[model samples]
Target: MGIWLGALRRPLLRALPTALGVVLLNFALLQLVPGDAVDALVAEAGSATAETTALLRERYGLDQSSWHQLGDYLQHLLHLSLGYSPRYDMPVLDLLLARLPNTLLLMGAALVISLTLGVALGTVMATWARRWPDRLLSSLAFLMYSTPGFWVGLMAIVLFAVQLGWLPSGGDGTVGAELHGWERFTDTLRHAVLPACTLASFFVAVYARLTRAAILEVQTQDYVRTARAKGLHPVRVRLRHILRNALLPVTTVAGTHLGGLLGGAAVTETVFSWSGIGRLTLEAVQAREYRVLLGVLLLSSLLVIVANVLIDLLHARLDPRIRAT
Candidate 1:
């Protein structure tokens, strides 16, 4: 256990600086944009006198030079205070915290669906050889992987929501419906079906293909044949040896995909018209809500960094070969 923990220490320590660099880079680019958050508010406020605009700018420290502003921003970040939102008129961290759970629900559901179905389907294909199930599932998985998430989302809405009236068109739950316990869950699930399916379909394809290839390769190794030759049942050989080795690569692939899942959720949310962080991020961009954009970028970068570190640890555990490093 001590050795295993020691192996993880260096990788995590290295990832910290890389994540910080990403946050700083994103902050720098956003600051370099043509205007700041104060200007957007001034423009939207329209009739505001120049004096009022000047006061607002000073109040928010937008009056500071680029270097001073960045320094202040970094100071606030160090304290875990993301600052206030000019548009939302609330604390940045509070706003994000409120919306994060909803976003997690949508993305989390899709991830769950993808991992379960993708692994099972992939294992089935690799184990079944040229059977009809393998051929059919492979073809379907290919189609899903090729199709765009947004396009798939739209098709689902048009077919199931609009045409068949099977689900709500968009947005959060109805008036008092969300106030009820299970009712909210049911409502959210119905609304989530299209978006989740759209997101999961592609992931399912990617994971299935990756797992199938990994398993197929592992199944042909000399040790695997020896296991079979030793009179172990075919199922036992495949499950204990082939599947275990195949999973090592799958764990790595899944870890790599965590970032993509967070990023891709934006497109899925837009298509489904869900009010999750992805949708919030889109609205922030349209409104030029600089602070909100900053928050989203920071949160995403941090999540990705955390995911990569976790994946590295998992990879080491799954494959003892990594321990030699």
Candidate 2:
């Protein structure tokens, strides 16, 4: 327990500065863009008088200098406020909270599917080593890794939703159905299938290749040789010795991939029209809703930081050497 806590402490300490840096960087980058929320609004409205434009800018604090705006933003952040979204006409934090769960659900489902399938396929590849199964699975993993996720999603929708009529093509659930209890859960799951699979595909390939490599490397270790010499069952040796240690690298890769997964989720959500943070992020970007965009980026940075910290603790638990150090 103390080891786990100690493992967590370092990452938690670094998180604040990391998050602040991300906020500052994103704010600066957004400032480089040509227009503010007002510009987008004005364009959408066809035209606005100079006075109306100025008033809108003042209303949203867009009239201020970049440094001044950033200072005010940091002040609001300190107060746990995410400012307002002119596009959504709501507090940025509130708007994010509403969509956060859908993104989380999509990410969580993708993670589980990727890890489960990747590890299994990797194990098979490792077991077969140089045979047909290993070659076939390796080729498949490479194909998945190279293919674009959005293209995969489009094909999935066309095949499953259009051709076979198996699942809904878009959105997070069936609209106006007033689904309840298990029905609601199942409907949401059905809608999630394509997006989750699309998101998982690339990661599954990555983990599979990584796991196969790690297992092959571990199989050559002295400990593994000794275990085999003891005449243990092949399955026990494979699982308890080979696969367990092989998973350390897999866990590290998974932790680092969270950010990538979030980025991929943005594309996946846009492709499927899923009402998640990713979709909201696209809308915010299109509308030049800097406040909402910044909020999303900040939240994403914190989530990745938190996930990496937890992964560190898990790594410690998995490897006694880490705890001892």
Please name the candidate that would achieve the greatest lDDT relative to the true structure.
2
| lDDT tens digits by residue: candidate 1, 85-162 | 878999889998998887888877887888889888999998785799899989999899889888888888888888
- Which 10-residue window in model 1 sums to the lowest lDDT? 171-180
For candidate 2, the clash count comes to 0
What TM-score number comes out for model 2?
0.98
Q: Whole-model lDDT, candidate 2?
A: 0.94
Give stretches of model 2 more than 4 Å off. none
RMSD of each: 2.3, 1.0
Clashing pairs in 1: none
